[model samples]
Target: MMAPNNHFATLGLSIGADENQIKKAYRTLAKKWHPDKNHEAGAKEKFQEIAASYEYLSSKDRREMLERELRKPAAPAPPKAPQSTPQT
Candidate 1:
């Protein structure tokens, strides 16, 4: 089979993204590349490719697996302290 579209690579998602991530990524990209909004030559085509990827990854079984993966709790972020102001 041919290599997947570049947009999928850029989004860091497989042909196997979850429905939620697919929808989220699609909306994010569509907003960025909508024809009237983007001047790039292939903006529309890029948007369509994102949509297609979302469709492929949003199937019932795949979506469930994705959801399970998403549900795994993320590691807690590192704690931060307020920066002290330097004396003038």
Candidate 2:
């Protein structure tokens, strides 16, 4: 199966979007796609996806944690010592 898009894409926002921007986008989309509010065939499903994305991105700590994890440097592998050849 194909993988789903990231939370940012689901909300139509960039990964670096601020909390305010995220909230604004989510509110706008949620209002537009809400099942009761829209009554469209796929509106309910779309709203659920949006809600899940918003819930995940809404947490400042989680966002920061993901950012830090992405930004952290990877450790280098240790060098191997030279091997000496012995007479057979």
Candidate 3:
């Protein structure tokens, strides 16, 4: 079974991806996995999921939410250790 967040995972992108990225990823995945192209039983479902994900992300409200989520500050990186002195 696909996960609740399968759309994000399938597209290999963050939830807040812009319309252009969403369209690009959808086109790529749709072409690769479309039921018309693939004979697999689940190909249709996969394509539908990708389409739905694109549609939702394309919506203005959802897009804003996604952008807000992505805009959170990233955790600070750990400090690097000091380098040892070089010998002459």
Give per-model TM-scores: 0.50, 0.66, 0.62
Task: List, residue by residue over 1-88, the lDDT tens digit for candidate 2.
Answer: 3333468878887666889999999999999999889987999999999999889888988776655654556566689999999979
Output the TM-score of candidate 1: 0.50
In Å, residue 27's CA in model 1 sits off its true spot by 0.9
Q: Which lDDT tens digits does candidate 1 get at residues 1-88?
A: 3333433444556645555766787788879988889989999887777667566565777555655555566667789988999999
* Best of the two (1, 3) by TM-score: 3
Runs of candidate 1 with Cα error greater than 4 angstroms are 1-10, 14-16, 61-88
Cα lDDT, all candidates: 0.66, 0.82, 0.75
Query: Between 2 and 3, whose lDDT is larger?
Result: 2
Q: Give the local distance difference test score of model 1.
A: 0.66
lDDT for residue 24 in candidate 1, whole number 0-100? 83
> Which pairs of residues collide in candidate 2?
none
